[model samples]
Target chain A: MAELTYRDAVIRGIAQEMTRDPDVVFIGEDIGKAGGVFKATVGLYDQFGPVRVRDTPISEQAILGAAMGAAMTGLKPIAEIMFSDFIAVCFDYIANEFPKSRYMSNGQVKCPLVVRTGNGGGARFGAQHSQSVENWCMMIPGLKVVAPSSPRDVIGLMAAAVRDPDPVIFFEHKSLYATKGEVPDGEIVDTLGSAKIVRPGKDATILALALMVPRALAAAEKLKSEHGIDCEVIDVRSLVPLDTKTILGSLARTHRLFTVEENPRLCGWGAELVSIAADEAFYDLDGPPVRITTPHIPLPAADLLEDIALPSVERIAERVQRSLQS
Target chain B: MAKLEDRAPAPKGSLNDDIGEEKRLALYRTQVVIREAEQRAYDLFLQNLVKGTSHLSLGQEAVAAGFAGAMRPGDLSFCTYRGHAHTLARGVPIVQVLGELMGRDIGLMRGKGGSMHLTSVEHGVMGSYAIIGAHLPIACGAAWRAQYKGAKDVSVCFFGDGTTNIGAFHEALNFAAVWKLPVVFVCENNLYMEYTPISDVTAVKHPAADRAASYGLPRIVIDGNDADVVYRAAIEAYDKARAGGGPSLIECMTYRYSGHSRADPAKYRPEGELERWKERDPIKLYRERLRAFGVGEDAILRIDAEVKREVDEATEQCKAAAPPALDILTTDVYADGGFAWRN
Candidate 1:
């Protein structure tokens, strides 16, 4: 029952988890005294000491590999990679070792690790600092992918990520960090792999994730006000263990669907969702599902170019209108 | 050899106690076991009993046997492709190990893991990854788990001198050093990363041990052919790690007598190199040390007979063991009950 930003909520969730479990520690490049580049771990170093909130070298491979090592041994580690673009540097560790350890060992080892990184392109940090690579991670098995759009969802999903027995990739949108929302003061745990209904409607469904959730909601409101379109908005909080039940249920009611994502169009998370819908809810669909996503190009440094590159509320609304008309 | 005056004093409290008669005999027996087991595996490979390639740890027996003896049951171990000896040293049953190599259903990993993928979690041997330098990160992860769980256990990762050149090794070592993780990186410098000699690839004189200082970790170089020396060095490293003194890198200078895998005949080695290494045969040296320490010849003979009998029995069991059921091919790719995301 307190107003908090997405960054503050994440910091509170990590601090709460560290307090509850001494085994939970944080590690990243500037997460210690600097409190993280986005300040997601602000005031944690002072409260938990350097051992808990560790400052690591500027080696993403080492940070991720060490986090996997720590998680497999016994500690519940929440490692930060600063930006999602840097995740490419640690792909071998994540794809080859972390995901394969449990299955290769026949359930003898479990990697209860959470890799938290800032994603999406709004601040125009160019191609390197701003990118949404959640789809790249989704291709790997044994990993759970989560992207929360709001501060409340961030806190709830993060707590669940910390407690889950599997490795989780928690992507925080760079644009959503400063966005204010009402987060529950007491402990709140949202189940992973479950979608939440952000706006209930009957005409069509707009499924979104991370920074796109607010855009989807905005599009839904605009469609209702101007075009008299009743659009349902569903926040896909977790992408890997996707809440297919909730999505299909919503699709069953709406009979039309469109997915909105900040990542590029080709082979993006939207493609996966569309495939799943085609496979499971084909008969329920009245029209081919649409996808409103960023163009298949690197995020540009200029604000105008980046704005055009990312999915916009107007574009999402237009896509909803097209899906309904089709 | 350098003069005594010229040599630096062995790091204080680093040297282990002298290997007594019983320990020396034990070391000889373990080396023989490894040699015989590896030979039998090669024989099986020739007969098509084992599928895929086999990497023999024939000449490097002293390193595996010695370090394995120093480890407690709860300590963790990760090794490279040439890992049969390390697995045996970690107390994996000869019958199960041989069965795995033979691709039998009763084998470790339920016959899924072949010669290079051997694993025995019950014995604290996580796995032996086939990829060079891949398991270093895994070892670091396990060590991090140990420290996080507040367990006193230590993790030992065994790799070849060649793996030190890989990025994964550097990443694992740097993290272990920075976080002060309880891990010991044991590099079995067998003079070659496959057919290429260490000197040809690495500019540093001591390719394995010299790299430890780069990561701010204490380094030790030892005569890998000597079981007593390897055992002492490994024990010290493991002890320091378990005591929360952070990580250490130990380079065991040894030689591989056989080909890198089953494909090559090791023709690349220069004349007299193999002979020179054989002159320092660890099993023979330990046996002589045992005899000089008053262990009866009768006792040594009895021990050798016992080990031989065990190997013979394991071979028979492996040959008789049936191939894995075809249904297992679909299993173990994901955790049982299916992945939550997929199903």
Candidate 2:
């Protein structure tokens, strides 16, 4: 096993896929030599050369369009949108072109490509650069959405996204890039639509995603040690093909649930999870499920305000402890 | 006033001498087939048999024929909602095109795509996008694929004049030019953006041709009503792209006889506009040219009759075809042949 940063995992994941298949190509702004704006794609240009690792102009529409076109014809493309917030500029492709291509063509055309974007907040890139927009993609019918919380999950899920026979939106959190974790040495390929229970417990279940996963884990540890509340932390990695079986199963045993989402409170991905639990595992819950999320407002750039806005470990533990006691 | 027919009259000189007689006849046949098929579709639409909206290429057959004829079998085509002619030009069966419009099981997309999203990958008609200018960059990607694979097949994208104003148009042109990909961007400048005149909204005289210089491409605008002229231009563009000369932008000056979609009656057109375009109708021009080139009247009449009969047969077959099964609704949403997102 090797200790790898989430940023290096992005490079290794892409290099692994490109090396495995000649059809796989990478395209984005400043990805070829500049190594991407966030440097998440560093060393790809040298490893794969110019043809496979392409640098496109500052045109999101063209980047996705070319990726879709290439995917439809033969190539398996991994296009990048510098920031998840910039998805609005090329929403037509995400909302209309890539997702609907297969259904509209009645299976004649397939867009088996990956659109990996730098997502989430805490970098103080302001409102336009730091939104968690995985919900935006998860709502779309034809797309598969996945956000990896750890270095190992990043490499494993990246392989799964490239291999899946559908358009996948890979949300790579910007703040989590510098975080390190142990990744297995050989080729790491995980399955989409599956959730991993990071820390097992018996008191209550807590669900989190991407940047929120680490926070939830910390909160769970705090709840166990300080509050005498043992909470099971589950990383809700894949949003669309959610592992509801695992979530609902956990809720049945614990009889309580809480969701930590980085997206705004309104229409957050947590809302969907809660709704599912209410419908499928209603009688299993002891009380109303709680949702811990960023407030419904533009993420402030100030460090203190941003921290206050996002669900903090203290807030998570306090909420879970108070709710479980009630 | 100069008669519209007199404007851009067939070049007084050689008529595509480089294209052989057999190839010229084939191009003529393709145009005739598109013209006849579109007329039948219009008739069916009037009877409310086609259901939903249909964008007929009533007077813009030559552009589809010329480009499709110039393309190799493996070459790809991406077109707009007004794409029946282009789809047919790529050799998709007439019955399948009609069935797709009729929402029958035998349709190109088995009644899923409807009229605007006609697609037949087997015939190299990649897709027909309804959203304006979305396919331009997509065509660039197809070209990029060919470039990456060291293949010679080119990707030809056809769109209306209004597409020149869309952001994707500029982005795609710049992308293709920068990458030096083998793609041809063809703009059928029919002088209308849906219901409005092209000049009313456009900043230049020729929407696509004027913008070519910005991308380091030569400005080319031709009479789209003349098959020979369009054919020659197509050959040059395809040859250049195939030879790794990068992309070429060609604006074909054509006109549509029908409204933007089936819903409009075309009352917005100025008086005598449709009549004037009809005078220089592509089918009429091609027929006269065929006669002048010593093609026997009997042979030309035989082709016309055969095309009419073929269209009639297709119309009959499509009318009898059933709508797709209910289960088809959930199929093809993913490559796994099922639309289930969760277990």
| All-Cα superposition RMSD per candidate | 3.4, 2.3
- List the lowest-lDDT window of 10 residues for candidate 2 chain A: A121-130
Evaluated at residue A239, the lDDT of candidate 2 is 93
Model 2 CA lDDT for position B214: 99
Query: How high is the CA lDDT of each candidate model?
Result: 0.84, 0.91
TM-score quality measure for candidate 1: 0.93
Report the error of model 1 at residue A111, Å. Answer: 1.3
Q: Residues B1-343, candidate 1, lDDT per residue (tens digit)?
A: 1111233222323113365555666677788889888888888888888888889998899999888888887998888879899998887888888888887877886666678878888898888888788788778767877776788888899999999888888878888898788898889988998889888999786777788899897557888877877887877888889989998888888889898999989999999999998887777766665655566789888887888888899999888888888876554434443455743
User: What does DockQ come to for candidate 2?
Assistant: 0.85
TM-score of only chain B in every candidate structure: 0.92, 0.95
Model 1, span A55-80: residue lDDT tens: 98787877887787677667889999
Which segments of candidate 1 are over 4 A away from where they belong?
Answer: B1-17, B144-150, B325-337
Which 10-residue span in candidate 2 chain B carries the lowest summed lDDT? B1-10
lDDT of 2 by residue, B1-343 (tens): 1112344444334445577668778888889899998888889988898889889898999999989988898999998999999999999999999999999999999999988999999999999999898999999999999999999999999999999999999999999999999999999989899888999999999999899999999888888888878887888888899999999999999999988888878898999989999998998898887777667789788888888899999999998998899999999877898887876
What CAPRI grade goes to candidate 2? high
